[model samples]
Target: MKATVSWQQALTFSGKTESGFSQTLDGNGETLSPMETVLLAVGACSSIDVVDILKKRRLTIHDCQCELEADRAEEPPRVFTKIHAHYIVSGDNLKEKDVDRAVSLSAEKYCSVMLMLKGNVVITTSYTIVD
Candidate 1:
């Protein structure tokens, strides 16, 4: 739950999580920006929940990928106003209802990052299952 960032010169930084994972972030477009990281966090968080939920239901999930599209406000402090999460799921005997329910549960209950941004961000989710 905790992370640290060190300056890497010229608006760039190296961030390390408590789990020892590290990433390079830069504001000059050389790497992932802070805002882009946030978007990624949201996508990753929800994807984890979706995959886990499906597995727990005894569904054989071969692969899961999420494509996130976001829109930010035009003015300063440009924060995300809308986010669309499109999940492409590949598995055996994956039911549409199950996928829909999994996504709904993640958005409404499981995903912490999505819950945190509930009010400020409009989040929408959809999924396509590949047999």
Candidate 2:
């Protein structure tokens, strides 16, 4: 519930929770940025539900990866304009209907981050089923 960010260097930091788990955050232009990390939080938050919903339906999951893209506003203070998450799911005998339903349920009903991003950012998704 509580956390802190300690400075590491220019555009880099380490954020740690009260429980002590920590992650290195950096504007390295390759992996982590502040805005990119926000999108990651949103993606990871929803991905949990997506996988859980699919698993409860008895779907076999080989792999699941979410690719998040965002359009940021051009202004003195930038903000997100739109966001999209493409879920690439690899599995044997996966059903498109199930994947669609799971995604829909997460965005519309289950995922809180998705709800928060509504209006400010247009959120959308597409799925690829890999056999």
Candidate 3:
């Protein structure tokens, strides 16, 4: 439940998670932002459930990616007012029904980030299944 972020350079940083894994975070030349980390948190939170739900349902999952969009408030400290998560799943024999159900389960109950942010942020999701 801890992490460390070290400055890598201007507008960029390297973050080490409690598990010792690392990732590079950058702002594409703008000032360093925490929004990227928030998005990553949301993605990671939902992805865990997505995979687990698919596995429990015996779905053959080849790959998955989630894209998120956030609208921030205009104030001294920007906060997300809304978030949209798009899940694109690729697999063999993937069922649209399962995908829909998995997403619903995650957003409605499974994802910790979704639950924690639910009251403050409006979260929505869409899915694309490729077979």
The C-alpha RMSD of each candidate to the native structure, in angstroms, is: 0.8, 1.9, 2.7
lDDT of 1 by residue, 37-125 (tens): 99999889999999999999999999999999999999988999999999999999999999999999999999999999999999999
lDDT of prediction 2: 0.87
Better of 1 and 2 by TM-score: 1
Off by over 4 Å in 3: 4-15, 22-32
TM-score of each: 0.97, 0.87, 0.80
Candidate 3 residue lDDT tens string, 105-125: 999999998899888999999
By lDDT: ranked, best first: 1, 3, 2
Alpha-carbon deviation at 65 in model 2, angstroms: 1.1
Spell out the clash pairs found in candidate 3.
none
Q: Count the backbone clashes (under 3 Å) in each candidate.
A: 0, 0, 0
Which segments of model 1 are wrong by more than 4 Å? none
Candidate 1 similarity to native, TM-score: 0.97
Best by TM-score: 1
Comparing 1 with 2 on lDDT, the higher-scoring candidate is 1
Report the C-alpha lDDT of model 2 over 11-91, residue by residue, as the tens digit.
888899999998888877644777887899878988888899999988889888999999999994688988899988887
